[model samples]
Target chain A: MNEQLAFTIEVFLNGLMAGVLYALVALGFVLIYKASGIFNYAQGVMALFAAMTLVGIQNGQVPFAHLINAIFGTDVHKFGWHVHSFAAILLTVIVMIALAWMVQQFVFKHLVGQEPIILFMATIGLAYFLEGVADLMWGSELKALNVCASEGNCLPQGMNVWLEGTTYEALGYGFFIDNLDIVASIVAAVLVAGLVIFAQYTKQGRAMRAVADDHQAALSVGVSLNFIWVLVWSLAGFVALVAGIMWGAKSGVQFSLSLIALKALPVLMLGGFTSIPGAIIGGLIIGVGEKLFEFLIGAPFLGGATENWFAYMLALVFLVFRPQGLFGEKIIERV
Target chain B: MLDDAKQADAQVDNVLEVNNIEVIYNHVILVLKGVSLNVPKGGITALLGGNGAGKTTTLKAISGLLASERGEVTKGSIKYRGQDIQHADPAETVKQGVVQVMEGRHCFEHLTIEENLMTGAYTRTDGNAAIAADLELVYNYFPRLKERRKSQAGYTSGGEQQMCAVGRALMSKPETILLDEPSMGLAPQLVEQIFDIVKSINEQEGVTFLLAEQNTNVALRFAHYGYILESGRVVMDGPAKDLRENQDVKEFYLGMSDEGRKSFRDVRSYRRRKRWLS
Candidate 1:
């Protein structure tokens, strides 16, 4: 009931919400890495591209409008029509799937059986390439992703009045919590649950795990490496879309949106690259740790902005103590 | 009557035929120089050789696993069921009923034993019921696998891991299995047990086996046919019985001769006396 305690609870809650967002992005990295041993440097750019495509589709903006105008000397941009948010999302998903296929077919197919470092480097090139393509398609402008705003059921933003009023009545001080954060937490929970079921129950899921364990053994058992790799890429794309939606809705879709992936790096180091549960828990730990640190010491003693580097510092500590992350599979060596 | 049936089998078309295949690694190191062999249906055929003698290369070529390692069958052809398959994908080869249980017991280390076996049936379109039935059949052959079915494969003993690898291959219901060095790194008793299972799998299931082994004594005992390889070439091949009784094989491989148990140092003068090489 103390005023400080209530505010601390509020900060802790916000940190948890932010952690959920980080885990969402980190989930994409874990999916591709676990399946192919490729770190997928383009995961952030994937989120950026997915968000950009969603906005372009929703507003019925012409793709490559700038390029078209430059070539034809005509000012043409929009189709003069609006698409439903749900339809836009569906189309975006289709586009993401197509992108996944092309990435596998054109880029990674030739790089099969290459060293992990080579694969990682290829993803870096892919990230920059995809970013340029998305920029050209959408014209590199910030777009507000209202997400069903046209339908009058837009993604809620700002503090929840109900939670604030109830907390004020009960504890003599209101707790501030964003409705968007609540939604993101719920989405993340559902996404994680769906992924776990898909991985643990399906036939293709079994093959995915088999490929992750040993590519040679999986191929010998008749599991197609190309198919599984594409499947994994598609899954990662789907995760990226979900993450992009949540983050974009919170702070209008922009190039800065992709920078959230940098935040996910520390979370992965803490959680372990190959673990799903590790990502979620690691995100939560990082979320709470950074927020609490900023509140207690960062703002007062370190003059604020400690949240920017607190997660990385904490992750570095974890890396030193547990190089495998909190839940990475231990390497087994036969002596 | 049995001898007549055996003679008829010898005349029948082979399930797998490799004709003078030359394997080059990284396009430079020639690992298999014109190696050739045949695997008859429902028989254990042993490819025998010392280390680096191209035993594993021959099996990988048959299974189409060489491509992953940058090894190419450049000079000759490999035919499975009389279809040319030198350039086929390993998964395609598996789908066509030929599977390779890779050397060194490459079990899916993180998966449970049952899950690891189930992965072998990844290409089967016969539904889970058939897969379950095959799983039970595999369990019957390797009961230890069934007991450790819930345990992570990497944690199981080496013998159990070998059994799991073989049992995993069986779950695919393969018509022909290219087994590479199943006896490697195991105790003598465990080696005998695995060989026994391979023999039974061949007899009861009527599955064809092309096994590569360094233990010439045991491979000769169980194999119906044998090909002895030396430095990327098949030096000699015959019925398993003949290879077991051949004079050079006795001195070099089985560690016995007419003079009885002479060390390699004592037999150095006879090194160039290999009649097949000569």
Candidate 2:
């Protein structure tokens, strides 16, 4: 193998790693979109809030710690709750679910029957509001999260078997892979598979599909729209929590985690807004295609950071060919 | 009409009674103006009218769909089984055994035929076993629906969709079924078939029916009683047999000319006077 080929392989693997993270965020988008027509622009912020809440509860923050102790009547700090990572994750998930319920019951319930664009704008407002609430709760400080894997640390780097017998060694270039990248890949694949099965086989999943098809029809059939909304939002919150943990472990949890959600917009556009499998495949394509393009075509002309626009450009190309999306149903209009 | 009203008032077993109801749309335009009717138990009643003549509006008002929105029974009351249900929700209406097979056969297009049938049983608290039994009954009435049970409603033909719609309403096991334009847009053969199934459903299930239809001839043939609406008001109403034999109805609706009416009257009186002489 040549130096060029080895570098190309490295870029491709890196793209796959990034795609996994994008898939997680995109999952959240798809979940909310399935149950309610609103595109939840606040999904990224929900992840940020969940991560911040986890840190706050672990650190014994003024209000959260006081409130928890007052309600449960147990001194969390004295009981040594801060030392338990699993407990913190569980508590953060619960708080996120409660927040989801509140959001549906108060904000969304009032805004029902509004136009989809108006609802989208409302979600944007929710995003900003949630970001503010998170900052107030956790002071916008950076925090570290432990990996959920029992291995206790990211996967270690090892020698590539394909590159072992290659002459690329002469150029000090070889296919490199990180332990954390490999684990992230595995986790992403598992999550995607789990979600696919859940949506396909479960009763709640069927209700979600029905609601996505026609909300008014679903309501007429007695599929409690409010309850489904809260359920989907909480499910999205769980996805966000997982995304937060993984991203927090990789880059540390901060406001920047919210920025990662912007990546999912192009993912949604490329895959079509309402598709679950489309999100996963789109994430992978955006992930690997961008990195390879950046290395092969982009580096020679526009320099680095070409990966940032590569997904959007590919998505733009797809829109021209199949406007509804790769997996989306074509919309027909009748007079 | 006042004497008929007095007679209906004396009857205690009225299935549904609509008294001088007014439905206004968008708080401005009146759709149903002082509309009133009564359906007797175990009989088919027809609401006949031309397009946009408040026929469909009346059906929706009784089914609780219109009452929830821009429609208000401002002037009168609706009693179903002696219960005031003017303000009832659709779910509550279904619970009270009143189901409407709405205009256009509003089947859930994306759902499977079987799933659409299950939705009709939404208000039922019975377990899966009873629902399955009802499903079998619906399938028996519309065998075409049974054949396409796993197919999405959108893929079904229009007549088949109508069957699924009516079948779904029956799955709820309602005492009264309101069908709006079940014969609309269907082939002539399918129209006859649908009306026949409706008649059987009435006879076998003892289900009271209030059907709104544009085809006055077919509606009168199947209905036990009928109301003829012209421009949002009932112009004439009586037993279906009497309406079929009425001379005014023949001239205006049945396409009978003056010569045909005169000959028919002469033949009828000649037969009567001959019988008196004998």
lDDT of 1 at B133: 94
> What DockQ does every candidate get?
0.71, 0.20
Residues A1-335 of candidate 2 have per-residue lDDT tens digits of 57677777778878888888887899899888867888999989987888777767665565444456668997643333343566777888899889989999879887777788999999999999999888766666687755443323232333333222323333567556655566667877887788777765555666666677666555444456677888889889988988887787778889989987888988888778778877877787788888888888898988778977888888889888877676664452222
Candidate 1 is graded, for docking, as medium
Against the correct fold, how does model 2 do in TM-score? 0.80
> lDDT per residue, candidate 1, A1-335, as tens digits?
78888889989998999899899899999999998999999999999999999999988999999999999999999999888787888999999999999999999888877899999999999999999999999988788987743344333543333322323344677777776678789979998999899887888888898889999888888888989998999889989998999899888999988788899999999999999999999999999999999998999999999999999998999989999999886786554
**Compared with the true structure, what per-residue lDDT tens digits does model 1 show for residues B162-256?**
99889888888899999999999999999999999999999999999999999999999999889999889998898888899999888888888
Each prediction's RMSD over C-alphas, in Å, is: 2.6, 8.0
- Candidate 2 Cα errors over 4 Å, as ranges: A1-3, A58-80, A83-94, A147-203, A330-335, B1-11, B15-20, B24-29, B66-79, B82-88, B228-237, B243-278
How high is the TM-score of chain B in model 2?
0.88
DockQ of 1: 0.71
Q: List the residue pairs that clash in candidate 1.
A: none
